[model samples]
Target: MEIRALVFDVFGTVVDWRSGVAREVRRQLPGVDAEAFADAWRGRYVPSMDRVRRGEQPWTSLDDLHRASLDELLAEFGVPGVPADARAELVLAWHRLTPWPDSVAGLTRLKERYVIASLSNGNVALLVDMAKHGGLPWDTVLSAELFGHYKPDPEVYDGAARLLGLPPERVLMVAAHTSDLAAARARGLRTAYVHRPAEHGPAATPPPGADPEADVSVASLTELATRLSA
Candidate 1:
């Protein structure tokens, strides 16, 4: 089936979360290794989600998870002079993450051809902020917060299609993370993988046990845009 809508994964696919958060933290707390802090904080994400997935902890929104991780990292690093309100403000940094060089342009091209929306684990407010900050032209923002579920879960993919009034095959899940694409593929959606070689950190490797199979793989969103245009 022809793809009419493209559902993008925001974190590393569209927005450069690692660099974005690091830059913001660096702006606030100068002469510090903000990139290291961003890496450490993001490192906590999966295990934090694991606790909820295993039912060991109550379900929490990504916003809370971002805050919890931020607080832990702040205490661990002994970073000084932080106000209480800044904690909330700092947590919102994820919302305003910067996009890749090609993200806005490539997505703009894609948007001319298809409906574009975010299918991210980020909350709606977070997604909205990222869009505004990064100038992402999205038709809509969809998040796990709305569904009370996260990616790698079939509902997040299938449910999005249901809401968008598109069949699974008519929607394509485009992501930098292949695990995300795998889940979408499981739900009968077309999947495209865009490579963000620096998504983790300068030295970070791809996540362990990622799927080798994807319907499409491209060097960057620009390449994906070009291919889809054809």
Candidate 2:
């Protein structure tokens, strides 16, 4: 099938969640290990969503999940001095994430040739806010909240293809995480890996190389644009 659309994993792929969250954490709680705090918050992301995915809990938005996790972490990190209003604002940090250096220009290039959209676990409102804040240029915003399932859940990937009126093979799932790509591939969607070495934090190690299971991989979105253009 000819590829027609590219759906991206927003958090670590298009946006730098670690630094973004850490920056907000530092602003809210000075004198803390912001990077480690960011990592710890993110570490709970999948597990938090898994509860909903497994039907152990009702469908919940990522925004709600982030708040729940944030509240718990605040207490754990002994930062209860943060006011409720401030904590609410801090939880919105996910909405204010910064895009990778090449993200905007690269997505613009790819958008010219493909229908680009977000395929993320973040809710639609969250994606919209990030796109506006980071100047992300997406044709549409698709989220697990829209389909009632998170990534690694077939429904999310399949739902994106369905919404675009394209077969699975006609849509490429782009992400920094190999596991996300693998899940998309398992559902017959093509996969592209974009390496994001510092997504976890400044000290995080880079992906060794292009993932063996990825149908295609590149160091940056700009490089992916070049490869697709060729």
**Highest-scoring model, TM-score:** 2
Off by over 4 Å in 2: none
Worst 10 residues of 2 by lDDT: 200-209
Best by lDDT: 2
Writing each residue's lDDT as its tens digit, candidate 2 over 38-139 gives 999999999999899889999999989999998899889888677888788778999999999999999999999999999999999999999999999999
Error of 2 at 29 (Å): 1.2
Q: What lDDT is obtained when candidate 1 is compared to the true structure?
A: 0.85
Per residue, candidate 1 scores C-alpha lDDT tens digits across 1-230 of: 88999999999889888988888788776766988988888889888877766778887989999888887888899987777787887788898888999999888889999989999988898999889888999999988777777787787998999998999999999998878888899999998888788888778776533236877888777788899982
Cα displacement (Å) at residue 146, model 2: 0.9
Candidate 1 Cα misplacement greater than 4 A, ranges = 206-212
C-alpha positional error of residue 2 in candidate 1 after TM-score superposition, expressed in Å:
1.2
